[model samples]
Target: MPTAAGHRAITTASMLTAEGGLELRPRLSEIPAHVGVIMDGNGRWAASRGLPRIEGHRRGLEALRETVRAAIDFGLDYLTVYSFSMENWNRPIEEVTDLMGLLKRFIRNDLKDLHKAGVKVRVIGARDNLKPDIRALLVEAEDMTRANTGLTLIVAFNYGSRQEIAAAARALAEDVLAGRVKASDIDETLLAQRLDTAGLPDPDLIIRTSGEQRLSNFLMWQAAYSEFVFLPMHWPDFDRRAFASALHVFSERERRFGGVTARGQADKVKS
Candidate 1:
C-alpha cells in the first residue's frame, strides 16, 4: 500500500491532470440524469396567501422556468414536470380555462426561449383533449423544440400515468388485432418504446413539492425504483438550493440494485 504522502501526491496529480479535457465545474457524482418533478401546491399556495389560484398558477409557471434553467445548469438530461393532469379537469371551469390560458401563454413566451436555450420541450399526453387553439399551440411549441439537444423538458398536459399505460395497452391491442405483432412478445421494453416518452431514459429521481408523498399518477410505470425526495415547500418556493440538496442526498447513497454487499456497504442504498 502507498504511504499517506504518496497517496496525497497521486490524488494531487489526478486533480491537476487534463485527461478528461476540461470542465467548468468539479464533477458531481451521482447527479440525477433524469429528474421527474411533480409541480404541486399552486392552489394551496394561493389560498394560504389569500390570492387567486390563477395567480398561484402564474407564479408556478415562472418557478418552472427557473427549474428548467437549474436542471440544465446541473446537467440533467430529462426534466419531466407535471403541468396539467386529467384530474385537474375536476376543478372549476373558470380556473381550468385560466390554466389552459396559462399553458398557451407559457407556450408562446417560453417556446422560443427554450429553443434558444437548446432545450427540447415535449407535451406528453392526449392532445385531443385540449381545445383547438391550445392544441395548435402545443403542436407548434412541440415542433419548434423537437430538434433541440440540451435538455428534454417534458410538460405533462392532461396526463396521468394510468391513462398513459391504458393508452399504450390500447395501442398494443390494436397492433395485435391487426396481426402486426404477437401478444406474447409484449414485454416492458416493447411497451416502453410505445409510450409517449419512447426514446427517453427512465427517471432517476422523482421529486414532489408541497410535502406530498404520493405519486399522484405521475410516471407510475416508469418510477418503479426511482429515488424520491419530498419537500414541504410549495412548488413556487422550490428553488435551485432544494434541487442541489436532493442531488447531495442522492450522491451520498450507494446504488447496489438489489445486490448483496460486503461489510463496507450496509448503511445506505439508492437507485
Candidate 2:
C-alpha cells in the first residue's frame, strides 16, 4: 500500500512518455495476469435513457465483446466476468428470459470468433438446475474452445461466491466421510482445489463498473488480496479506454501481499 504522495509519484514516473506526453496505457510488465470484472449498471443506464432494460443489457453485451478483444490485446492470461449470478433469477421473468436469450445469442453468434481468436472458454458455477438447452450451450462453448491456448475467458454464469464456497466445503466434507482423506488433510489448498475455479489463478485485479464499490457476491474466496478498480461508467459504456484506465490505476498500487516494503521498513525505523 502506497501513501497518497507515493501513489502520485509512481503515477507520474510510470505514466509519462519519453517526450513528456501522458501515457494512458500501463506497461506490459505492469499488467496483471488475471482480471475479474463485475459488470453493473445496465438497468440504470437503460432507465436514464428511457429505454427498455433489455436494450441496456444488449449494449452491455457489446461492451463485453470489446472487453474480450481488449483483454486479448493486453496479453492478459485470464479474464473472468460475472455474467449472470444465481440471484439474477429473482428478477422479473421477462427480464430473466431476455438475459437467457442474450446468453444463447452470444454463444451462437460469437463462439466461433472466440475460438478463432484462441480464447479458451471456461464456465464456472452450478449447472445442475439450468435449462437443458442452456446447459448444452455452455458445454458447447467450452468444448469448442478447449484446445485454444491464448486467453482464458472465464464466465461466471449463474454464480454466487458464497454458494461456491459452501459447495466446496460440502464436497471436502463428503470426501472426508468417504475415507478419501483425514480431517487433518483438509486445508486451504485442498479446499481451493475443490472450488469451481480450481485450476485458475486468483484474480490480481477486479474491476466493477457503474460506480459500484462492492464485490456483489463475486469471487469472495479468490479476491482475498485483489486490487479493485471501481469505474463510474455503466457496463454499457465500458471500452478500451475505460479498461486501460483501470489498468493504469492498478499500475500505481504497491501490492505488499501482507509483507512490509522497503519504504515501510524505513518509515518504521525512522518513527
Candidate 3:
C-alpha cells in the first residue's frame, strides 16, 4: 500500500499531461480537500433485496469502511459523512435501537484501526439527549484519535442543519445579551465560528447517494458554494469507483462562487 506521502508525490507528478497540456481527466492531486456525503437509501437497498432494513444499514457500514480507506489512500484531508440525523428519531423504535447498536459496534470495532492509520475522529451534532453509553462512545472515538494528523473523519450523527444554525444563532444572541458581543458586530464569519463545524473548512464537494437531488437538511449554511454530485446507486453500493466518478464530475465543473469566470467575463465584454 502506498503511504500518504507517496500518494502526494504521485499527485504532484501527474498535474500535467506528457504533451504539457492540462490533464483533463480526474487527477489524484485535484481531489477536493473536503468532501461531504449524504448517505441515503439504505432501507431501499435492503428492500430491493427482500431483506430487513437493518441489513441495508449493516451493509452501508461496510461501504463507509471502504470509503475511509479510499479517502486516506487518495490523500484527502477531510471526509464528513451524515451518519444519523435529528429527524431520524421519528423512525420506529426497533429500527432506531438497531441503528444505535450499529453505531456502538462500528466505534468499538474500527476505532483502533482508524487510530493506527492516523485518522482523527470528530462527531458533530446535538448530544444533549443521547443515551449515556452512546455519548460515551462518541467521546471515546474523538478522544482516542484527537492528535492524529492524517485524514479527519467527521461523522454528522444526530445532526440537522437547521438545528445547528439555530443553536449558533441562539449562542450569539446570548453573548450579545451579556455584552460579550454586540449585535451590530455579528457577521457571517462570527456566526460561523459558533457552528458545530467551526475551524473546519467548508466542504468543496457534496455527494448524495440513492439518486437524491436535495440537501435534506444537511449542511445548509456550509454548502452554499459546494458542488454537488448525486448518484443513482444506494449508499450500500458506494465504493471507491463511485467516489472517483464524483471527483471526476467535480473536476470538470467550473465553480464560479457566484462570480463570473474569465470566459464569461470575456463574453460579457464582447456583448
Per-prediction TM-score, please?
Answer: 0.85, 0.91, 0.90
Candidate 3 regions exceeding 4 Å error are: 1-26, 269-271
In model 1, the Cα lDDT at residue 52 comes to: 94
- lDDT for every model? 0.79, 0.89, 0.88
Better of 1 and 2 by lDDT: 2
The numbered model that scores best in TM-score is 2
**Candidate 2 per-residue lDDT over residues 1-271, each given as its tens digit:** 4422112212312366578866566445435788999999999999999999999999999999999998897778899999999999999999999999999999999999999999999999999999999999999999999999999999999999999999999999999999997999899999999999998888888999999899989999999988899999999999877888888788777777788877788999999
Name the regions of candidate 2 deviating beyond 4 angstroms: 1-23, 269-271
Instruction: Give candidate 1 regions above 4 Å deviation.
Output: 1-30, 261-271
What tens-digit string does per-residue lDDT give for candidate 3 at 208-244? 9999899999999999888899999999999877887
Q: Which run of 10 residues does model 3 get worst, by summed lDDT? A: 1-10
Candidate with the greatest lDDT versus the true structure: 2
lDDT of 3: 0.88
Cα lDDT of model 1 overall?
A: 0.79
